[model samples]
Target chain A: MAGTDKQQDMLAEGPAIILVEPQLGENIGMVARAMANFGLAELRLVAPRDGWPNEKARASASRADHVIDAATVYETPSEAVADLNFVLATTARPRDNFKPVRGPVEAASDLRSRFAGGQKTGIMFGRERWGLTNEEVALADEIVTFPVNPAFASLNIAQAVLLMSYEWIKTGDQAVTPPEQALAPAQKLHIESLMGYLDNVLDERGYFRTEDKKPKMMENLRALFTRPGFTVEELAVLRGVLTSLEKFSPRNPRGSGAPER
Target chain B: MAGTDKQQDMLAEGPAIILVEPQLGENIGMVARAMANFGLAELRLVAPRDGWPNEKARASASRADHVIDAATVYETPSEAVADLNFVLATTARPRDNFKPVRGPVEAASDLRSRFAGGQKTGIMFGRERWGLTNEEVALADEIVTFPVNPAFASLNIAQAVLLMSYEWIKTGDQAVTPPEQALAPAQKLHIESLMGYLDNVLDERGYFRTEDKKPKMMENLRALFTRPGFTVEELAVLRGVLTSLEKFSPRNPRGSGAPER
Candidate 1:
């Protein structure tokens, strides 16, 4: 409650990530982290080997406590997905069933459309080692598989969830903002002013050596400075540095551009 | 070599994955697994904390041995990606720099298009504790980030790699076949014939009791059966079940739908 500022719970309405007999607490924690990273909230655990309220899982979750805290535990996969209208069981290998198989993107798209239609949809992930059994795969409406290397297609539980969650976030309408503490980019005029000031200081330092090549050299210098595109804060910092250098000239103390000391 | 057959290396020519001072062997292994899952081959390490050839890493990698085996080590970030024409640094937080910022999808598309133009492209991932230094990020042509939940945006190293690798695979022209060993769907006529046979059997068994509601009930049952669009295998299985049920009739020896036992 202290760290988490709840704002209508943007992650409340996505597909449930039901982990069936997940082995390691660390993997579960990592899965929760991945889910949180992609704004997926609902987490259902079916018969975890190490039991519930796992300390190791909470520790590894790294402040994704919301996912862990709100997690629901069930005894079987059927019970885990009982409330959902549609379920997708994720498996690496193909099963001997006729269920439609979807890649992550297509599955996510389906999940988005289904969620929009008020359908309670969930995606089930199997265990770390053996993956989902054919019987377990039969319970789902469809199967989801990662197009992994056929020779060695064993993906850890968290990795599989991450792929699905990433696609879900990408294809869904959630707005995930990159964490930022920086200022907005400066206007073009502000950047040009910074460049003009720097050019004046460089000229005073005789940085433009050849008279005939001065314009081209100045143009190249300007191009180089502006190549990466300066932000407002960055331009301000550059201006501060240039002003500092300008103060170093004794005769032109305030950067008057007088030929001096 | 026994398990992994070389097939002109579909993963060889894509973007490089440069890890800068990655801390854990488990994370490295997971990263390799994520890369292999998406067919990204090139891995460059910049001074890993536990050093390379780590047994823990190899063990955790599952069978992404090629990613770990062909991994290259360097002393610095610049040295790690020195051969690349373009580099994108991954970060959770925005840095005070002038580099262009792109989300994973946009970045992967750029990587794909740039690699198509014969330019070697790479993406840099930072350490576990602290991300890439500002100087390290400055060396990159652009910054790539996961559009993650700002409230708790700390994604583990492997999750970052998986998202990027997934995008790379999505935007690239690699043949990623889902492991499907099933038959094509049956014809509409076949399904209709099966349905008619089953209807006759059910009718003899008095499954449709009320005459007034019989048509609506039959229509609903037909819709339910047809909704999933059964494949040939599924239809065959259904037909076998129907025939087995028919054999229970007493009046007919070979399930002729004559009621009486």
Candidate 2:
């Protein structure tokens, strides 16, 4: 009750990650962490082999206590998924059930659509050793399998959960934000000044000996500098590099102008 | 020289997964398992804190023995990626460097293109605690970050490896295969016979006494049985379900023909 930030529950309204007869407490812990990594908070357990409030699981969660603490346990898979309108059963071996088979990416999109339609969704994972039985697989609406190497198609419970969870979050229109806390990009004025200094320095060093070809070379140089749109700090670093190189120049001093000089 | 079946390497050719100064052998082992799940084989380590040939990592890798057995180690990030023509560094924190940032999907596309051109590529992951140093990140071409929950952005070594491996595998033009070795579908003639039997049973039970509605009801029943394309085994299972349901039907007895009777 102390961590009653209930708003988090609704905001992170990701699909419930259901583990049916999960064997290890450590695996449960990792599953919880994987869910947290993708902003999924709801967790359900159907007859866990190890009882709840497991200390090992808590330790393994690596601080995803929100998912661990709020986890609900059920006596059966049907009860675990009773509230879900859209359920996906994850399996490695192909099933004979003839249910629509989907990959994790497609399943993510499906879950997102269902969630938007005000439907509660969940994913069911079976036991560690074997996997979901035919009866258990029948509880879900569809089967979602990974496109793994046929020779080595086995994925540990946590890794499987992470793959699905990773896609679930990826389905959202979350644009990739550029690096945060990064320096602002340098203005065109700053880039032009840096380019002028570099041109003067390069000309002084007789680097443009082929007279006619120098125009295209200068164009290429300008493209390279303008392309990256260096940040303010980066422009300074470039100036520093130029200054350090000029220090070794016995022919010219550290003066900013060279071609004009 | 012993395992010179290099063609397997080319067919399963994937970008190298580099761990820089990873601390634990167990973590490295899980990383191998994660990579193998997506059919990635190349693994490079830069000065693993626990050293190579670690028994803990070997056991932790589950059964990804090929990846573990062939894993290469280097003294530094540079040496580790020396043979690679392109590289992408993964990070959670935003760096001040003015490099172009990409999400995992874009990074996977980039890797695929480089791989197509016969150019080797690798992805660099930083240490567990702090992550790739600014200096180490400078070694790569660009940064690829996950669109994870900002509230909890920390992904353990194996989870990070899994996300990248998953995206890499998804970028390929792989199509989803249907379930494996399922029973042969019950013929359409069989479905018609089953439907006709059901109609007689329902009529005998006085379920279609509403004469005008009986045709529509029978049509719906036919559609239901025909929709699933149940296999021979599945058709038998359905008959079993019907038999069990009929046992409770006090009035009607089990008979071969349906509405005909």
Candidate 3:
């Protein structure tokens, strides 16, 4: 029952994933799995090193064989993306010739909106050994790149695909709430307000003096307060302590700093 | 030279390294090395199974003997933290009565500010075999926990110290500019401008129909743009494309968008 619905969903509103000169069948399969993760099913293979319909590719695809089965084979990248009104080429390295580059999140959001507007979009990923050639990148309307650690920028094709797909899925499903963990809405707000009150009190005490240093100081304070995810009642108790301190301080002659403490 | 400065710094504002009954001397030395990696030099031994000042620890410390040299021996956890105004106990398992837990980033920020204000702050980490006892955790003002994969939370002492040190160094040196790599600054601004232009064009075209949804859409777009850190020139070119699109569209009869293009 899930399989049928998945296939139907794949047929509708899915972007075409074009792999350019992919080397390994394992990578191809992994890419298929990644595409499936974000509800993308249409895979277009453009000139592979390991032949299409290979068992290795199918095995690597795991449960995402539906995407592999539904894939379209293409002789060239241009052919694969010919029908696409919008094409985004993925690369880690920057191009010498300037082109509009968007991060995964922005590109995903744009693609989601465009897809909803009846625009056919194709996101192209390069091979493992070397990324997309200069000529190949020039063919796309826009470039897409992932923000990765510079020291270890070389990403396995599947990981790149997964990150991109995750962002795309997030942008596409705006209403779907992410998995709920410990932090909730009320707790978050209460924490923020508590931090705000603390900041105000600290500022009055001249704790953070340097003008240039204020932003960092406040950020450090906020980071400390927000991390705990305090409840409303917990915050109220903290505020009471602050009020008691203000009242007890001998400097406050008129009790302007004091509350009902 | 480095060793002497490290020792002096440790004496001045050294972070209290509480090892809760750590078994191995090699692990302690590795922790010292990891601490030195981020300017943390203070070493506190809390009821270690192995005797203090072990040769194996000195060997592992390598050039970071300053940490091992200034190490303070403690028979109990309470004695180790008696001088500290704020004490944070690190653990993987959550306790019901434990003070609210925070991630490393928040904990580091809190420690930095507290230390700056002349408050003695100590962060207690658990041993390899068995972590900090619930009774030990109850003595802490806060609990510090790393966000690790739940299935595999068993981190080596040195690795845990390294992670915490990384966060501490980042928070402590908040004003220090990160080392610049390739990808020119101009390109970054260009990317920003291009994103702005695209958003404006989309807005003018009524692409964002719902007023309520506009802020969220814009925020998502901003997140997408900012994540990759684009150059100004890149942003400018992106904006040019948006301008061209706005000019060519049927709704906007004028060619005003061509100016930037």
Candidate 4:
């Protein structure tokens, strides 16, 4: 169960994302999956060109059944945001209008405040080939755009949704630290003890020659063992290997290669 | 020309995203789209379940035609990332090993620094249903996992790619500002003139009656005009509306209901 809960928290609610004239069902499905990744639900489709409930889209959604099931259909962009008090339209190009424009971060902050004040807000995404029309953009209070590379700014519908959703989740206070480490790491002392045992065995074997250089040789040996920062299990395995090799030493009193004990 | 320039940036070189045994062509295409969104260009597929040259994948890629076009296929994940100096393996469940585990932000930062040092790097994503195997995870220098909800930590393939790609772009030094405004905003004097014209029309219409309430009413009117933070074009539209209403007045000798030349 601890494995399952690693830094995972309950899902959060977010504004509806309305996709207008989306061309592919696969894009629709991927958008749903992207939204779910950031704990967002409530998807709106405004007259998809290929229509809704396509098998290809459903298959592509992977495991996000709830999003696909709860997705709502609308006849127009205005109809999609009819019940919302505020709306933001996503565009790649800056519009020639006076509406306040915001990058994804600012837009996400504004959406968070609006949601906190008990306002129904939604984001409208235009068609895949061409984004929202001027008439459609006029319906929104603000425009949200990505600060993308000027030389290559074409972002698919799902990528756009993912960026916004990621920012929204990041704004909220969630414990982003990895889940409590699954296993307790072995301490330095544990490795030191293992090193001491191995050193004694090596001393008997004449592995450390030149009495004057013994200290430096021991230090080098310790460094090698500590480099990978072995876990307790790894240390145990190394101890087993050493004991087994000592048994086959022929230095043992037993005529056979087994340890006398 | 700017619109066309958008799709032409020499794709920002980043880590190779190797998909090990990806099942569907649709998932592969979506992954390519996600990679392109943030300038990541290298895609290596290892023994895909559905084989190569998938039509579904090509179609789903949308405008990431280049990514899919240059995608390379490999016999295994090891082969895919063999040429890179460093590799990262993604896994949903925590492994019982001593490998350093990083969240997306830290991983992106590390990848950025490594790229700066002229080292080739890559990240491996596992199959659709079950993630990377233990042996495969063992081949990496580090592991990265999303801090998703414990109850539902499953993120589809494309979503995983999107998250990593988003972080990669975010950590870079590129100017993340929106392009220059298409139309420079109107000066304060323009809005002031429009506000003055509207006030005169309202006074003539007897909308601001009680003298004591005039100042408060006027202050409220000014606040309303500035609330949406109108652009110059918006002010022009408001001024046009006021002139149109003043036309039916019989107060104007301009029979055309238009302002005098």
What are the per-model C-alpha RMSD values against the true structure? 28.6, 29.5, 36.4, 29.7
Q: How does residue A259 of candidate 4 score in lDDT?
A: 74
Model 2 C-alpha lDDT per residue in residues B1-261, reported as the tens digit of each score: 123245434335689999999999999999988887787888898998888889999899887778888898899776787666567889996676656789998888767765655657789998999898766775666788898877766698788988899888887773423323544345444555576678877888999889988866775565456445465578778888885676644355455335222
Candidate 4 lDDT tens digits, B174-252: 4333423433334334545665686787777788887777765665564455434355787888877677667654555
Q: Which is the winner by TM-score between candidate 1 and candidate 3? A: 1
Instruction: List pairs with backbone clashes in candidate 2.
Output: B200-B258, B200-B259
Off by over 4 Å in 1: A1-8, A174-261, B1-10, B174-261
Question: For this target, which candidate reaches the highest TM-score against the unseen true structure?
Answer: 2
Against the true two-chain complex, what DockQ does each candidate achieve? 0.26, 0.28, 0.01, 0.14
Best by DockQ: 2
TM-score of chain A of each: 0.64, 0.64, 0.63, 0.62
lDDT of prediction 4: 0.73
Better of 2 and 4 by TM-score: 2
Candidate ordering by lDDT (highest first): 2, 1, 4, 3
Compose the digit string of candidate 3's lDDT tens values, residues B1-261: 334552346423446778888898988987777676566767899877888868898886755667788888899876787666567778876666525778776788877765565556678888787788665675566677765423223355765676566556656555433334434323223333454576777887798899988765665564455444344555666666756666665654455454332
- Candidate 4 error regions (>4 Å): A1-12, A23-26, A48-60, A149-151, A174-261, B1-9, B50-59, B63-65, B174-261
Model 4 interface RMSD, in angstroms?
3.4
- Taking the tens digit of each residue's C-alpha lDDT, what string does model 2 give over A74-172? 998767876665578899866766567898888898788656655577899989999887767765667899977665677988888988988998878
Which 10-residue span in candidate 1 chain A carries the lowest summed lDDT? A176-185
Question: Fraction of true inter-chain Cα contacts (below 8 Å) kept per model?
Answer: 0.50, 0.58, 0.00, 0.22
Question: Per TM-score, what order, best first?
Answer: 2, 1, 4, 3
